[model samples]
Target: MKQHLFHGYMTKNVQKRISEATTAILPSEREMNSGINKARRAMTPTIPTTQLFDIAEPFTKTLHDDDFLIVDKMITRRQRILLFASREQLKMLLGVDTILMDGTFSTCPSVFDQVYTIHAVKYDQSFPCVFGLLPNRLKTTYHFMFQELKSVAMQMQ
Candidate 1:
């Protein structure tokens, strides 16, 4: 198909050589993926870690309402964002004693590390109460998550 696209541009000899080379050694899937990854890495722009907070600041500010709800958020130096629950969600979380925490990597974006979630359980059902994008599964990150939660909970009161 590509050869056809460049049909008139290439000489007959050049076309024959390219065709023979392609047929003689077809690239494996791994080789194709390696080239694709290389191209993507080259094209992808690198954002400074500190600048990440600046980029998200506007979006986080918009999450708030007139009731002062949706105002709780934690952002680390590495740009890990732990978006806490709203006033109503926080109330529900307080009602439950056994909260669950889980990290989902498959849904995580390449920009961050993982999607760490907090769940509140009631009546044998688990409800996701909070969401965070962490740079890694570091102890400090997890500590920040809880510290932010406590700070936010106090604010809700």
Candidate 2:
């Protein structure tokens, strides 16, 4: 019989400890989210900020594109961790059901309509994982992404 590293499901104390650790490691809610209500404050994606605005038409104007799609692996295993942080941050900023449909500005919330859209960066799985408090996936993924990015940089040079 081996001792388990974690429980089958988190206990209340475990959840509390983890939450406190996360708060310390990340930031206080006020510190983590200190810009949403401000006028025209923006975030660089890496830093958590507040700017809950429309999701659809703005994408076209900002990206200068008319067509787009978002796809991803189902939330499970490591994805659960990733989606938790990403979606939590997004919710802190943009609320839960804010992203647009068809990239043409239609509102939908049909379970599959606009749900679980979380990513450390753009929902590019190949872009590298960003699962915090994970099984150290971020470190390895960052290492691989670094190599890939370096290769592209060399090609440009």
Candidate 3:
């Protein structure tokens, strides 16, 4: 058996794999609740020798869930802090009562990595908190993810 390494870039194949994996996990498109483990498929086989901390667009899966939820992406240190900062600001403005807690999480189980820049949000009066960790590595991908998230959050607001 050979273990495939993951890459930072999000390519066409990556999307396909992510969709496949997600569908395999949630075949009925049922509501994904807390403590629900998703899928983990290698998007990139090999990391670039020289690369920036930018992850390709379209992300891996669709983020159509707006219910009380927490999402943790495997990002890096820079991304952790920056993303936290951005979300924190937005939460304050939106009066969402969001918190940037310290913890570790992953989309895939058996991975001991913990995400630092964790965000907790409960939009409606439904769930208590929307909690999740960021990506694992503190590589450039983290920075890029944070920047992109911050940018998007800014534009959305």
lDDT of 1 by residue, 12-111 (tens): 5555677776755867657977999999888755554442534343344325642322423445454555464556667888899899989989887776
| Candidates 2 and 3 compared by lDDT, better number | 3
Residues 69-112, model 3: lDDT tens digits? 22334343332322323334346534555555455564422333
- Residues 1-102, model 2: lDDT tens digits: 233434423344555767665755765446634655343444222222312222343432214342222112223333311111222333332322332211
Q: lDDT ranking from best to worst?
A: 1, 3, 2
Largest TM-score belongs to which candidate? Answer: 1
- For each candidate, the alpha-carbon lDDT, in order, equals 0.67, 0.31, 0.41
Q: How accurate is candidate 1 locally (lDDT)?
A: 0.67
Best-to-worst order by TM-score is 1, 3, 2
